[model samples]
Target: MDFRTQTSSLDALSGVNADALVLVLAGDTLPVGLDASVAAAAKDAIKLGDFELKAGKTLVLPRVAGLKAPRLVLACAGKASLKSARSAVQSALSALKSGGTVHAALAFAGFDSLSEALVEQTVLAALEVSYVYRHTKPSAPAAPKLAKLSLLLGKDDAKAAKAGLARGQAIGAGIELAREAANRPPNYATPTFLAEQVKALGKSHGLKVEVLDQKAVEKLGMGSFLAVAKGSTEPLRFIVARYEGAAKTVAPVVLVGKGITFDSGGISLKPGAGMDEMKFDMGGAASVLGTLRAVAELKPKLNLVAIIAACENMPAGNAVKPGDVVTSMSGQTIEILNTDAEGRLILCDALSYAERFKPAVVVDVATLTGACVIALGGVRSGMYASDDELAGALLAAGDAALDPCWRMPLDDEYEEGLKSNFADVANVAGREGGSITAAKFLQRFASKYRWAHLDIAGTAWKSGGAKGGTGRPVGLLTHFLLSQVR
Candidate 1:
């Protein structure tokens, strides 16, 4: 579909002359069809509520014979308000999305006026949100469908609005690309493969990128992350992406992502059923990498440090077993009571190591536990934080980005879930209130710095193939980073 801006209602006439839908704002009766008499009759029909036209309502008119009224559709924008106008456009778009087959155009209300940027941003947001991807397991190639979209704005307004849409669409395309990466199969999206993918994205976007292999991970004392990777023949991978768009003196915002590319419950060993979906376990890291790609392209005036602790967690002879104690970079020992509780093990060292970068703030994302999914369901992710102000900022950013998240509790009472007799903490507690305990474990590693943990277990990937790739809260990570700039 070609979603472009049209300057005036007259520009729409040059396009395909099929049945068209022109959304008009209702006010005092307006002329419709070819003759003034015909327009008067149409007005009478509207007065009689034949088409059921009302303020802030949508009325679809059948084929007629006027330049703009032949297939005229009236969508009420109450009293020429900006919000109402935007609502009307969105309603029309929703109508189109829900199966309206018309060359769509929004015929402007000649009396009302709006800024080009506002119009462009509104339309752009609508178009981006309305894009529905159709992907099925049994794939078939077919011809495309045509559902053209046009906005009739003033000449100057059209140019500015289209430019705004162009910019927004570019960023959205990057986001969609990352979402697809997050949706790929486990075998196809291994740690090494993702490392290469991030390297490619970094190079293209003019950001600095580096990857540390298994040997490097061991050398850097990433014991917890390495323990999980020990069972898989596939090399463990750790990636760092840096975006420098501010002055050298500015402190950077750091993003840490748990990239367990494929988790099979390690030595604890997951059940045989539904393990294939572990592919999307790396969604958090993919979102972080995607944010780097977008920030570099958008050239936001900020400094960023993105880290992906990428590895595969499988059950093999070499895998770390239960009751094993491992010392992290922070010199804190953790007892591995259940190897399935491994994401925090990997992320703990990652979060502690981030201290070297001297960041003003740090945020970590992970699909850490099913407990989070049990608590929040699939629509919203669980948010845990050590700082009240940072949590507030994140909540606001999530709302602004339309990547909804709910602040989950991180009470001190849950701290006992991680206490161990010998080590500093145990990997897992009993099944009761598991999500809060897992968060409590990660909180121990984020001392001093303002940090937030996003548990994306529920929102990372859907079970029965949702229409879109990836999920919400993925964008929230990027949105949070962008919000932190000065």
Candidate 2:
């Protein structure tokens, strides 16, 4: 979709040329700047009980006497806030989805402040609602015809609006990329396919990309990562991608992603029901690629590296079983107590590999544990960071991007559950604080650098009717990277 800023006075709004005109409202009261005729029409609608000032509520007026557009949409935001603004945009777009509306001009009627955040959220909401996963399902309805979105802002807010629009568009594209990759069926989106996708991204963005096959990973002594791949015929791929916008002397921020392309729980098989959703186990890898695409587009003056341990975990005759022991890239041994707990296994090796970058900070993203979904639900991703400053930056970035994360404790006590009699540590800990224990396991491999772990099991993808990848933490990660720009 195309996004642009338009400066128009309230009196001139009726003359703005577009297929639809969207006005965001805070209450029943009409905005002060609306043209006399437009204000009268809006007031009459409210007086007649046709519209309510509730968040996410929307009403459409068609071909009003003085309006140039064929339709007028009143999107109730309730108040001037980012969340409300996003709802208002989504509601407005939803109202116009069926219509042949090709372009829309969105205006904030009673919003007291027209900030960059408001514009950014508007773009994101529109793109999100506009997205349709048609790759596998050919019969799925095509996305809406809405192609252009104009944010009607005051002249003073134009600069901020432009910046926000650019950022929003970049992030939206990245999100779509992540979602598409994650939504693909495991057959089509195997570890090799993911490596190919990253290679294509590197080619398009002029980044350095490397794909290490099973032999190379074996040579690197990523026994923990290989253990998860041994069950599947699909060869494991260790992907390392570098985006260098800074000099080589600058230490980069490394992102490690758990890329279990299709996790069937291996020998510790999961229940048959809903096992198909395990295709989304690569959500972290997808989000890492998504963030890399966004960063490449923004061209931030900072170096970034992505490490993905891509493979599949299926129950086979040779699959690693409970009580099996394997050494990681860091030379730490792990006891595989539960093959279902495979995300952490691959991530530990990838995190260990990240040390090669001599990174300023390393943040590993993974759909690691179901306990996180029970703890934080889908509202927030679980975050565990050893460094307070890095934790604070990520928290602030999540807030700014509206991809929120709640910091979880990294207390030493959590590590106790991971102790193993046969190995240095156990891959599976007791059920208590499962998410934190997973983070603690990864933390062991990341001791050489400032590190944080994002457990995105709950937030990466929705289930049931809305089942698909969410492209989460990409916004948070992108914002965090941009914040670190020198």
Highest lDDT against the true fold, candidate: 2
* Candidate 1 Cα deviation (angstroms), residue 190: 0.9
Model 1 has an lDDT value of 0.72
How many clashes show up per model? 1, 0
Q: Indicate the residue-level lDDT of 112 in model 2.
A: 69
Name the top TM-score candidate: 2
Residue 203 C-alpha lDDT in model 2: 96
Off by over 4 Å in 1: 1-3, 9-64, 67-138, 141-149, 154-167, 465-468
Give candidate 2's TM-score: 0.98
The deviation in Å at residue 136 for candidate 2 is: 1.4
Alpha-carbon lDDT, every model: 0.72, 0.91
Backbone clashes in model 1, listed as residue pairs: 64-70
